[model samples]
Target: MPNPAPVPDHVPPDLVRDFSYFTGPGMCPMRGGDPQGALADLHDGPPVFYAPNNTYDGYGTWVFVRAEDQRRVLQDAETFSSHRRIFEKALGYDLPTIPLEIDPPEHGAYRSLLNPLLSPKRVMAMEAANRARAAELIDGLAAKGHCEVMTDFAFPFAVGVFLEFLGLPQSRREEFLGWADKQFHGTPEERGEAIRTVIAFMEELVALRRREPAEDFMTFVVEARVGGRAMTDKEAVGMGALLFVAGLDTVAAAIGFDFRYLAENADAQDRLRADPGGIVLAVEELLRMFPTVLMTRIAACDTEFDGIAIKAGDRISCPSMVANRDPAEFPDPNRIDLARENNRHVAFAYGPHRCLGSHLARRELVIAMEEWLKRIPAFRITPGTAPLTYGGHVFGIEDLRLDWEVG
Candidate 1:
């Protein structure tokens, strides 16, 4: 039973051609080394719209700019829709994930399904608990003085927070963790195995919630309503999968990438350690540089601007990673300056679909950085290590190889 008022059906060719960012060959085509370079690319070009690569069809993007020319693009909900079917089509799932890919007024209702628990007050309540959890993990391994930051710290930290929030028991936490890790990982074959295991577990949990109705996020979600009608089981499951990825791995990537960048730049780490207050601005800068998720969205109707053509039904991707470094917005964008005030970098994106979990993510990051810097501020990256890089749909380091000391 498809919802009434089907997704808009008239994407224009002119609009598609001018909106190109993620359709081409590179990951972050602009921001890393020089902010000026980023601005030039966004400005000097013919309005930075999507252009077709020779190899692909119906794929293009216009990475939006933060400059005066396009400031309203992020806030203009009417023109830029967030209905996210691109992933479903790519992954071959007829059913879509909740909220992340959907647009208003449906997107608005779906988000209400989980927004209460993610509110700032709730996040503050979780912060102390998160700090304790971070301390426990760090204390357990502080003596070792060296570990695989990704697997040892970030992975467990992400899963533990999510599991606790969902109120999963100790016995079943690993089942959820392992399955969720692979749920967004590997080939379709690998993905199928992960999806089945995790969904089965979620179904069982849903049943348990039905019977017992424990006090947790699981119960909250199970009992969520829109216009007074309760969410269905499938809706619950779709949202389960959504939250699993949304709450867990993206946090993992954000933390892991931050560590990798800090490990490589001891000078910046020293500065951060000296001030500590730098943590907040440093957090903003890091987000500017290392937004983990890439572009999304397929246009709903024909649109045109800047002499490019975007046609209806064309697959378009909006590249956030590329946009944040856009030189027109952030001068010297590659360099991280803690004092970069008025820095309106759109790392979490803009508009109605701007990352709902931004608040929670920022809190976790601030805590994680505080704990790490307090204990291991002057650490050096392990000698003889050429840091390995991994990129797929997302970008992060495989292992942040570092050997730190505390005297």
Candidate 2:
């Protein structure tokens, strides 16, 4: 039998209407023009509010909209644990997607094994390879005059990096792309199937690597250890699957949205084109304005958090999409100020669980923006096509068409 609605009994009647974190008709609506707009209004109403709209088996959750509050939840994982049993219940399976699913001390060990590949220096060393890939993709579209940036450039460029990182064959793009969609955008059944498919593939790959090792992220995990003992096959598979999902989704969507914004805003495009040197800083500001992931935490004990009563086992969501838009933390939070100062945004999230791949993500975005602007002339959204969007755990721009001058 399905669970009943998770709405709490103590929510103020007036504030009940604003609980818009989950999807469905009466649930919170994602602000139409601005993805974060509904959340901006939400910040005005409550620091932490009960939202009954969670679509994962109708579970209720606490929505955290303030930056400081978000920081508190993410940093203090003891109070707000990272264990994701919600997925277990929703998908009807046990999936331990490492580091991200574990809290503190245990998480550190898993993170350490992968840290070398994502260090700033390592990511910087890959700039030449990353730039070459970006240029290759952008060159193909330069002569065509217009293209769907999301499909043609963003997805391929980002996924290409992921493929190279894992030493996976490029011929498998279509097969893996299908799995990615099912894992993230498909129906619950499709998502469950996708997880099974990925795990199966990883188990096979790990078995192969065990007999004949190679130089890649997967091989690293297969050979790595935790606490002086080798990682079990299950642990390696969990880490690999998480990396596959995280690597393909976030950076690709971010690059797509950043280009979509630039397509509509000529001034911002012109400024970056002229300065060139400012692309690094521009990427930071862009991330601040368009953070896409909403992180989840489960409360560890019955406790009072920021005047709100949170019971043990309740769920809390700290969306970087919401926290980055806090007015008090960011002045003129709605406006995209490329020159914004002291931009301490949680676009990569906050605390111990902050994204391990942030350095690589940043490098990819910066190279992508710089390379695209260099090759493609001034571009704008196709006059009549409606841009398609999806909002949920990971908000995405499904279709983005751009028209540009053909040389």
Candidate 3:
């Protein structure tokens, strides 16, 4: 389902092209369309500008398009805080989503609990399971010779790994994904309902874990401590809710976009298929080109940035979609260079609130790509059918029909 909510009126009609911040029209292009072209135009203008409040609900953010400027905002958490309230304001949600919404000092504490669980070692350990799951999914689709990647493979592959990691029911995969899609791209009412529905389910799951703990992520979280103190049930539920929403959609979107890129660029696909060892480097470049998450911050105090005046409580939108495409940061920003050196893209973000699931996300991407190209012959979008995509808080492919020879 698409976001039926109307684009708020306060968003200047003209800013649509330059405000390539959201997923609607100007930002996310049709499959094989050019989004970076619009973002590049914005970069040619002022580095920082005021986006309208209607773009969000009651408040707007100062859009940052330059990579250097984005780093300045992300690195200086003291000036631009990541406290939960800012996100609540940006997305109109209540109840602080731990780690992501919490600022430094305390933020580090939340990361502590989750760090080892998603560490490179732990993620590496899951490689066999992840690869097994990927191969299973491709096995089901390979015989078809043609399939929609988003629903058929990407969603199931990404969400399956997460459900297994969390010890959630694999049978509820569709129900969980439906809720996640609505939460990100649905109307306000639908988004609110999705949040409530997931949180309610999480609350129940937490209670179940407390009474009869299991060997799962939820059990680990409930048994863990932050700052040497046990997390309250509310905090535990909040973390579960956060993981439910965050874990599923992000990696799924990355897979969707990565495959989308490969579908369009057969040469790149061939190169990866030829050299599996280079898949890791190829994944990094793909993430840089199509980062799905946008990092938003609130001005903690009155501040001046790049000759622009920002006041306390003002929102700052540092969209990786915009920042990663910056010519000053990545040479030939539009082209994908698998061996690009020192690719310090903010795809995983920067500072205290960087993505905790980075290790898992990387592993998932690498496994998905390697397995897909190996099983299926070279593929591309079916002629005359445009692949669908959604924008807003997160941008992703909704429908991608790929066709290949049945070998």
Candidate 4:
């Protein structure tokens, strides 16, 4: 095991916990592991504690386990800044991931510019295409009897929709998927290379859109104005890079986890298959139970939070999985209630930086489930195989071999 970062003197010794997203119990890669469920145990610990070596880069972070505290910390952006320059280490320079890293007043303008493009109405309009894409992928897989979820349907379907939105050619689908895999799951050196590769692609895309404007997201960004001025090259590249990274990974991972859940729970699968209308609500419940992202913030200045001393630059981690499982937030938090009401779960996060693509993501998930159940019959994890799950910057499942009786 690598050496853990030293705990800051200001952090009370009693508050420090030997926890890490990369190395925590059930967090590491394991077959049939429940990374998110493993984190639910955090509720039994202190509401807030310092976790040494929690981040991908080996920095200590203050972990908030309760939904209420996470909401407060996430909602109060000024105190806990979101501008962590997350891609700086990989890119070797500071490149804020657009509106995600921008705070409040400045964040508002960028969000306003992009929100309408992905609003509920817009997502509804895109549903037909999304549905068609999901159906096309599922149709191709139905005859196979058994297939790996990620490569067979999840990544292709999710990334296809993302590529369509970005106006990229589907011919490069495999190439783009390769970059995404490397960036998210590859070794450190490979991840850096993938990051650089994606950035280069985005830069080229920005230039292409500027010179030969098209009716696509990149083109819109190239010509769009933010803060009463045209977006700079860096800003355009940042936006595209953020979209490429964000759009490709999380939704696909979500689809993987969602299918894994259905594969294990035949009753849930049968219910959703019998009552397709319930899928919309079921998707929300599934999201609550298996969220994959961890929101991290850097302290803007030293301040006391709930009697805890937080110094400037301290990392605050608000794990959506842990928060979603907070008993105070959701009664019987571990129960998989398909008809869960008033969920208000933070799968997309809370406050100003809530995921901009949440609407699109929700639509994609709902459509995926609807199409799968409509086309494929009851299925389960293929016998003699297991889905490998891991926790890190993001939680993901792989080798999700699912099987069903063939005609």
Q: Give the winner by TM-score.
A: 4
TM-score of each: 0.82, 0.94, 0.91, 0.98
- Superposed on all Cα atoms, the candidates' RMSDs to the truth, in angstroms, are 5.7, 2.4, 3.7, 1.0
Q: Residue 171 CA error for candidate 3 (Å)?
A: 0.7
Candidate 2 vs candidate 4: the lDDT winner is 4
- Tens digit of lDDT per residue, candidate 4, span 1-407? 34667899999999998888888899999999999999988888899999889876678999999999999999999988999987788888998888899988788999999999999999999999989999999999899888999999999999999999999998999999999899887887788899999999999999999899999999999999998898999999989988987889899999999999999999999999889999999999999999999999999999999899999999999999999999998999999999999989999999999999999999999999999999999899999999999999889999999999879
Candidate with top lDDT is 4
Q: Which stretch of 10 consecutive residues in model 4 shows the poorest summed lDDT?
A: 1-10
Estimate, for each residue in 264-309, the C-alpha lDDT of model 2 and write its tens digit: 8999899999998888888888898888788889888988886677
Candidate 2: give the clashing pairs: 20-28
Q: Which stretches of candidate 2 lie over 4 Å from their true place?
A: 1-4, 8-18, 22-32, 86-93
Q: In candidate 1, what are the lDDT values of residues 1-407, reduced to their tens digit?
A: 11222222343444334222222323323222222222335444544444443111233344444343344544654455555552353345644567766667777888876777788887998888898888778777666767777777887787888778878865666676677556554554566677666666677888788779988876877888865799777677667766776777778777877887788788888888888898988888777777776544454676764544555444444445556666767888666776687678666767777777788888888888888887764665577664444433455454555676645
Instruction: Let me know the TM-score candidate 3 reaches against the reference structure.
Output: 0.91
lDDT of 3 by residue, 98-201 (tens): 77777777778888888888899988899999999999999999989899888999999999998999898899999999999878877667777887788788
- The alpha-carbon deviation from the true structure for residue 223 of candidate 1, after best TM-score superposition, in angstroms, is 1.5
Pairs with backbone N, CA or C atoms under 3 Å apart (clashes), candidate 3: 23-391, 23-392
Stretches of candidate 1 exceeding 4 Å from the true structure: 1-46, 49-79, 86-93, 170-177
Local distance difference test, per candidate? 0.63, 0.80, 0.79, 0.92
TM-score of decoy 4: 0.98
